[model samples]
Target: MRNSMHHQAGFSLIARVLHWLMALMVITMLFVGAGMVATVSERHAWLLQLHKPLGITILLLVIVRIGVRWAHGTPPLPSDLPLWQRLAAKLSHLALYALMLAMPLIGWTMESAGGYPVILFDGVTLPALVEASPGLYSTLRFMHTWLAYTLFLIVQLHLAAALFHVLVRRDSVMPSMSTGPLPGAKRSKG
Candidate 1:
């Protein structure tokens, strides 16, 4: 009973940890990406090294996060949230998940098309997933940039929504993901 209560109150421990860890990682990746494109210094190479591995790490974590979400499921929204808001929540979450999967793949493909190898860490390299071509590289790079900007916007929307829940709404929405026990651990109303 005590065990179940904790699990029901919020996201699983693993889920919470992954959510925050990935959140920080994604945000950092965004900044690193921006810095890489905005600079022309030797540090640019340093940023690229960090960005590629970080993106790949995120790519892998998101896969595990999806699996956790699938196996454990999400907590309910505030019971009183409007239908439109609820729909928006669903759509936005879908967009987030899609972007999480797409962005890294696009980055990887862009590197591959540019005839560059992605080193995961310590001389470990990920295989190139596409044929090398400067033309293909340019297209992939453009697509990656646009998708990244889209991700940035979507991330802002997500943050705003979370803040709304924490401040104005004063609901359990953010707590479900941020702090508390697993989502389904709470006892039933009956």
Candidate 2:
């Protein structure tokens, strides 16, 4: 039989690890992106170098994460949760997934339109998604910046909802993604 802690925690070990890993990577990428845009110093170049590969890594991980979620469905919400809250949860998750996929693609396309290379590492570069065009680059740059702002807002809301589950609701929602045993879960006295 599978271990009780794993069962009680709701999410598989791989899922929980991926969740936390991607969360950290995404948050770091957001900060790096903000820094990259906010300066013209030498540090801007360094941050840009960091940003490209990180965004691509996030794009790849989110794809894998979606596959895992599809294979091993997410745990159910609290049974007593209201209908509106459930709907909000579903919509927010969908938005998150959409942003995860869109942000990297748009960024790559923007770079392509600007005639810039997306170098992942030593001598590794991604192919251009679109032909070079200043007009298209300008449009994509605007969209990328605005979409980044939207992503930041959605991320904040997601954090607030997670905190609500942990602090206010004191529910299994938080435990579902945790590696530890679920709070208040029954233990066998073997």
Each model's Cα RMSD: 4.1, 4.6
Which residue pairs collide in model 1, if any? Answer: 7-182, 7-185, 8-183, 8-184, 8-185, 8-186, 10-181, 10-182, 10-183
Q: Which stretches of candidate 1 lie over 4 Å from their true place?
A: 1-7, 181-190
Query: In model 2, which regions exceed 4 Å deviation?
Result: 1-9, 180-190
lDDT of each: 0.85, 0.84
TM-score of each: 0.89, 0.89
What TM-score quantifies how close candidate 2 is to the native fold? 0.89
Displacement of residue 103 (Cα, Å) in model 2 is 0.5
Q: Could you tell me which 10 consecutive residues in candidate 1 have the lowest summed lDDT?
A: 1-10
CA error at residue 5 for candidate 1, angstroms: 16
The digit string of per-residue lDDT tens for model 1 on 3-56 reads: 222335577789899989998998999889999989899879899889988998
What overall lDDT, based on C-alpha atoms, would model 2 receive against the true structure? 0.84
